[model samples]
Target: MNKNTFLGITGLISCFFFSGIALLQAQSKSADLKNWPKGSSPKEIGTRVADHFVVTPHTNFGKPTPPKVITYPESCTWYGALTFAKASGNKKLTRDLAERFEPLFGVESKMIPVPDHVDYCVFGAVPLELYLQTNDKKYLDLGISIAEKQWGPPEGPRVKEESHEFYKQGYTWQTRLWIDDMYMITALQAQAFRATGNQKYIDRAAKEMVFYLDQLQKPNGLFYHAPDVPFYWGRGDGWMAAGMTELLSSMPKNNPNRERIMKGYTDMMASLLKYQGKNGMWNQLIDDPEAWAETSATGMFTFAMITGVKKGWLDKEIYGKAARNGWLGLVSYINENSEVTEVCEGTNKKNDRQYYLDRKRNTGDLHGQAPILWCATALLR
Candidate 1:
């Protein structure tokens, strides 16, 4: 009886120890999120960005032809809008965004793009989010249908360099090792876990994140455009920064890879702090001093930093000013139309540095618009 009593008391002590740690962490995050600097507050910035998404029309996919279907950039922006609407307590905006999605469930069903690639797979996240917010099974069914296809064996022709064997190893058949895939793949999977309370989705994402960190992350904690394309492109790394943040946020504390992932995230955040431009932006080529200031990357980095500080991953005192400065600098790029500027246009991997430097800087691209809303939601959440 005494032995059993001692064991029971020890277990109780262990539980309290863990519970106390969790409480303190929660308190740390709550304090930082609530005490925002004047103009950089999430309430102010998030609302502006959310309203802008409401007013914006369907994107053209950056082409001259009309947009017949939605894509990742728009999907990301939509997900961001939903999160911001909920965080800001804007019921009208939430309903408005829901109404916007209503068409897809009815006559516009065909407009939902085929989730055959990484970009299309991300479309699932929005619907999953809709399900979470409204508790509607239609949204849940539609989203899981799309997300489940990600891990299935290849049903189509393989890309030139992609491996069909990845499915055997439990990775999505779409694995290409592109830095962008980090966000494209992990964001959807993380949402799946969030909606369903399943461990597999977050576990898979954490393993995938660690793999990407090992293979792509440079010594200084930035990634090259691709394995062969050696330049450290801005938005490319932004995808990683934001993706890591998303994965870390949803993963369980006991996840085997969590500590490694945390190390990688903090390392990258430290490096980002080193390269921040005078105006608090990261350059188009992150390591190139002459590269132009880019808004999308700046917004993404800010979002990651803000989230890190709130979650206690980063020291609040050190990252708070940097995050605030990034928010202020990023909004300065927005024009009267509420469009973000200096976004690097959609890029393909090329081994040439000049190719990246010469890529067009677009105004009002969804690539740029998506991250601002994410930053605001990060702040509000």
Candidate 2:
């Protein structure tokens, strides 16, 4: 070979060699464990939660009503349990979660959600995750279809001009600035990115997040229920926190939105640290000391903090202490039945503060349970 050809081949080999080394190093780092406090250790908690998920039948937000369609809460919980199973090397769990989902393509096919809304579209993440673990083409097709539908032609009642306008702007027809949509939209697309190694999925998610951040996030780094609603609802903020975490986890390093999204994420974390109750929980009304401590938001924020610290985005010593306390504080709310308590019931935007403060506090709510599982999954990763 000529000298030029030899140098080019050598350069290619060097690139592959370094890339492999980096990959191994990442795997090794993930494999290493930190000594965790009891009940807060990811391995213990993730496995326990994963096992619980396998036994739990699909329910509509943990209510008694027959849930004809799968919901975002169940989808998120399923995805988290699946990841926990994969991370911990639990083959039995991997099988159990996968088997649990297989029916969606068969007997329970009718139960699959229609991707008309953000909540419905997030369900795609679960099948995408299953595809990652099992290499099932059926799962891939189902998930990609759902994810694509989010950005596809706006369907359903054509009453709203906003849907058409949003679609015209190259956004999901379902685009609404609701804090919950951040997680709903991000989960599906981020998982698609992971499953296919596609930059478009992550790019779309990051762009959507930046829009939400610009439109909804406040000077205090928390989000109101809507642009008009002034209250800082805990779980709503949790959705934004978790959404940002998911998007950031998958976004490419050179993504144009990376800096802005990172800034928004870090700013929110700082505010969360300041507002965290002395017991390591965030209040139902995040900024309201009078509001009761809510487990769901605490769990979501804990997950985000743990992820940030793990990824070296935050000060380890400072955020680590806070994250540990958040987990333990969160776990304290779990009853013997394994249900989470003090979860605010499903909420809607209201201008009145008492409406939020007086909202029913639910026991054994999936809103609460899902976030705890997310925290456990973050710890494991």
- Give the lowest summed-lDDT range of ten residues in model 1: 24-33
- In TM-score terms, which candidate is top? 2
Q: For residues 1-381, write the lDDT of model 2, one tens digit per residue.
A: 999999999999999999977854443234233665456577777777678778988887656797989977888888888877777888899899888987887899999998899988888998898899889899999999988888888878632679888888777889888999999999999999999998888888888889899998899899999988999999999999999999998788899999999999999999998898767789999999899999889989998999999998988877887887788778778777777789898888999999999988898667887888788777777
Model 1 residue pairs with clashes? none
CA displacement after TM-score superposition, residue 27 of candidate 2 (Å): 29
Off by over 4 Å in 2: 1-33
Candidate 1, superposed: residue stretches over 4 Å from native:
1-40, 158-162
Report lDDT (Cα) of residue 303, candidate 1: 92
- Model 2: weakest 10-residue lDDT segment is 24-33
RMSD (Cα, Å) for all candidates, in order, is 15.2, 15.8
Expressed as tens digits, the lDDT of each residue in 46-79 for candidate 1 is 6777788887777776887767888789999999
Model 1 earns a TM-score of: 0.88
